[model samples]
Target chain A: MTDSINATGADGGLGGFFQNLTDSIISQIPFWQDVLLPALWDGLWVTMQLVVMTAPLGFLLGLLIAVSRVYGSAPVKWLAQLYVIFFRGCPLLVLLFILYFGLPSVGIVLGSFMSALVGFILCNSAYNSEYLRGALQSIKRGQLLAARSLGMTKMQGVMYVVVPQALRRALPGVSNEFIYLIKYSSLAYVVAVIELTGAAKIIASKYFMYFEAFAAVGIFYLVIVTIATIGIHRLEMKYAIPGVSGAVGKVSKGH
Target chain B: MFESISAVTNSAGYLLEGVGVTLLLVGLSLLIGFVCGIILTLGQVYGPRFARWFVGIYVWFFRGLPNIVLLFLFYFALFPFMGLDLPAFGVAVVVLGLRSAAYQSQIFRGAIQSLSEGQMLAARSLGMTKWQAIRSIILPQSLRLSLPGWANEYPVLLTDSSVAYVIGVAELLTRTSQVISRTGEPMILYLTCAIVFILLNYGGMMIIQYVEKKVRIPGFGNNEAECL
Candidate 1:
């Protein structure tokens, strides 16, 4: 078992099938380790960069949109709503295309990386704002009033009191969105950003090992998604309160 | 603004034609998804340990990969290796269908699980076999309960179908880009496609909402209890 198995060309039986599988897999190990891993690692780095750059800005912009929707004038609320509807309605691929290919005609050409960044932020923020807005609304107005009565300004109340609770409530949804972002960021390749899937695609075409290349890419994503899921679950547990609305009380509502 | 408006010309009916392909892609995938979803749900809820294990793996594999990657995998690898030689459009539909099944199965599982064991017990006591009990007692209410979540799938699938353009499916997004290449109206053309997509999103939701309203069994529903 320590050495690589090379059962060559056994045919016909179930045992032969296993032997062929062993030989094929042994042959693939060198190709996978030497060729696939290095290219995919580079692609994964770009993918991570896309996710990292997009998430915080997207989170902050989503917060602004959520706040405006919750606490702004009538026109301001409408504008935020319109923004979410338009941005969320357009698929990310189309949005990226609009930024990359479409914008040059109107003289606002973004390079591939920049186009992908802007497009992901726009799409991400819209959904994030929706989740945040829901969480924001779920907070009772009495808390805001109480903060104001305690000599805090309206902005101060929101900054100090309301936002913390809303964020906790929004955590599940936002983390869910973050998972989606990791998956959807693959679309950046459509705009010519050579991210993980892009890297896999190039190697796959060059070697005609589409299954191996793409399956490796899938493994990379599953690992990323599983790690994110575990991390998010831990965050949820760390912040879990004894008697919170989104946290505890809903969990016991079984039939 | 007027001159710009006049300059905003489109490829006559070509993009509109894509709307049909897009709908067909989603429609076919979702139809297959619905049937397969029911099977997956049944396995998850009622089948033995091995069946449940198989369903879990199916859902996990489909859900873990991104849309474009799966499309490329099937188009370039799976179909070719199996000697199926499905057209790219066929491959797109199969991938989307399998993916949608994974999501929709969860919706059905949640709906079915939300119903208490009391119903099954009652059906058993009344001389109904397990299969009959499920057919008559369980499915009716659970299917209705799953409507809102199932309806949410339309928009999800619609958005996903746009990814088919990567493999040249002649979908709305693909056609919109074609129009843009010829007319150079990226802003106007893309904007129109966005609006069309938005309308499709809301329009389909509106119909689902109508069906939901029509199927209301008063005092037998949870209000906006999100399954996902």
Candidate 2:
């Protein structure tokens, strides 16, 4: 009984709690040193790969959707609208699941990585199309008329005049979408692509240092998002027209 | 596809059961999320500098991390330390609600900020206390203005609720996947889930549109029509 009391005195005191806290923090360092850093780099690489592949594809798809909505026949326009609404309305996570799990059974198996990439591209395009369409509409009808009066063909006018201006005006919204896409890519883990968040989860499970592992992942995301924000701001400044720069300048400045 | 439909219909009851769980998750999370949102908004807009900073970090952490990661962190990491036992539904609600608060705070902050300063000044000139002025004037207008954003966020929350499936919440998509795994009819089950999701989203949007039509400022769009 005396020995039991002595052991309890050592174990069940403030010192024990402090010791455990110190151990938790100490155990986390090796996790950061060995597993966290490599996983972070791998995750960052995969995230960049998704972004690079999807951005252009998503933009092209968005451009096509915008053109179809604006210039195509009524049925085509209706179809475009339906596509945007359905995709934008549903969550990307659900879309990812359908592509990864649902489509395979139909004998339409997309490799897991491709499934995540394609799903993200489709959803991002749907959203980007809406922003592009809105930006296109916001450009005055006078601009198109002015281009036509300059003896440019309809296609030439759109390519040379309307698109360049619309893209500039759409930069802020597109940048916002890019930030969203970066964070959204984390959802790829659900479909088992072993992206950053997935990598963090594996490390956390392995080390039992969930706080440190996930906190590192969060810090990495914050750095990327912050950098993206600054880069987009610079791009916005470079492309902004003189007179209409005020509103765009204001929003970006506040950020 | 036809074979897939027959398989899906066979498991319709199970899928509906999943939908029930999804709805419950959405309802409970939204309730808790909205309350947290209001408190956070109040803190950012009216509290001391330190309070604002604290709230800002809360929003940043929750919003920056992915929902799945957040769910895992809470369920696996925090729950064990707290030693408070809760079921899967409780954990789902807490995680989703906490994340939703971060997003809703930004939405509310933007709505509140959009109100003209003159109105608040006018209320102050009439001897109303700051809180009184906000309660009587600012909040009413801000709430109406925020309805559209809030409407959009509902479907977002609904779709996000699917993360609950990972933690075994048995939501719609999870149940549908289970059915497909059992019957080997993925096409129909997945398509049904997608269609049901689309319908729910559209339904929410329609309600928002109705509210928007009711509350729209009468003179706002008149200038565009005149210019046209």
Candidate 3:
């Protein structure tokens, strides 16, 4: 066990605890500067790379699956449903292990990074399809009927009318998936891809400074998610209809 | 590969032993989480402002943080500071249980909030104390509403129990990995683990469906009908 000092005082407690905590944090700075800092940099790069590559691909694939499930012919719809259930029911880690290990056996060898990317995209697509499907379903049937009555073909109606509304509605959920994707990308480390958590584990093991290493990782995630939240908020505001602002404001206030 | 399958067949008892530990971790953690969830849900629904704030912070921290990171912190960082030297399994149970509790609280809170205010008011009007009203009325209704969500949470917990591998808990995933490393047939071993997880999730969902069907009030067949 370590020292159990009560840094907080009964009266005027702020200064003492602040100083002690500051000292504790500062004492760990060298460890970070030498080892953990570099690992963090590498981890951040890998995580960002995964996010940038996977988000759009996964989103588009999910959109397709959602559309197929909702608007496609019977066979297509069944296939989409099966895809969603199979991927959604299983964990991402298992999916990753299967892709990384199982594929190589059948003469389908893939590089580690590619395997991780494919696994992530597949899993994310399934989860995203569920969200997008719900969003798509939420669009009033009357809206689609109106587009159809306006001389638009089924594809044209969906592309021009249904999709825009569904996309707007799906933004919040997609943003949630994006945040989850960032965290889930850490699982890539199990396959020896040195993402943020993996980097932290390595540094922590090497330096025996688990506190500083993990705290740094947490801060990185918090900052990224906060930025993402603010960015998505702005996007929501920009696309929101003028009259809908009042409704959105009321709903948010209720929450 | 054939040899490895033969090995598995011969060591079926040993493999079962490992599965037992995995189930133990999942079962114990889920049980602890359910109990903690109920308490936290009550706190959120009826407790003072400070209690609500505390519970809010707890849920935010647990949900936002990665479980593996938290497990590491609990095992390597927090345990030493707390002056307790718990074993790997103990650490896995506490960490997973606490994390699951945070998630379960949200589920329970959502279920409780879905109940109409009129029901609580009616119960109180009937001369019931606040706790009495909650115990006699709210809890039963909330439990019913929460079952489906709780069912989903079970599979989530099962999937996440793999995090116990980080702390050397020797769960299914860890054992599978160990077997693969030794036998060099990663495909077979890992695939087996994945199939097992899929079956577990499907089985859990089936059980939830059964429970929901059995306990559903007469004429309230659909979930939304019950909610209404």
- Model 3 interface DockQ: 0.29
Interface RMSD of 2: 5.9
Candidate 3 backbone clash number: 0
* Candidate 1 lDDT by residue in tens digits, A23-120: 75688998899998899999999999999999999999999999999999999999999998788767778888888887887899789999999998
TM accuracy, model 3 = 0.86
DockQ values per model: 0.42, 0.42, 0.29
Candidate 3 stretches greater than 4 Å from native: A1-23, A241-255, B1-11, B218-228
Query: What are the per-residue Cα lDDT tens digits for candidate 2 across B1-228?
Result: 677677878888988888888888887888887889988998999899998999999987876666776777677666654454677789999988888888778878888898889989999999999999988988877767776556556677887888777677788988887887788766666777888887876776677677677877766321111000
| Candidate 3 lDDT, A1-255, residue by residue in tens | 122234333222555445644677878777768778888999999989988899999999999999999999999999999897677666677778888887887788876788889988998888788767877877789888999999999899998988888877777777777877877787787777888888998888887877677878877876786687688788888888753221100000000
lDDT of 1: 0.83
Q: Highest TM-score: which candidate?
A: 1
Instruction: List TM-score per model, in order.
Output: 0.91, 0.88, 0.86
lDDT digits (tens) for residues A139-242 of candidate 2: 77888899999898989888887777777777777777787788788888778888888888788878777766776787788888778878989988987887
TM-score for the A chain of candidate 1: 0.88
Highest lDDT: give the candidate number: 1
RMSD of 3: 5.2
lDDT of 1 by residue, B107-208 (tens): 889999999999999999999999999999999989988887787788788888999998999999998877667656678778778889988877877877
Residue A141 in model 1: lDDT? 94
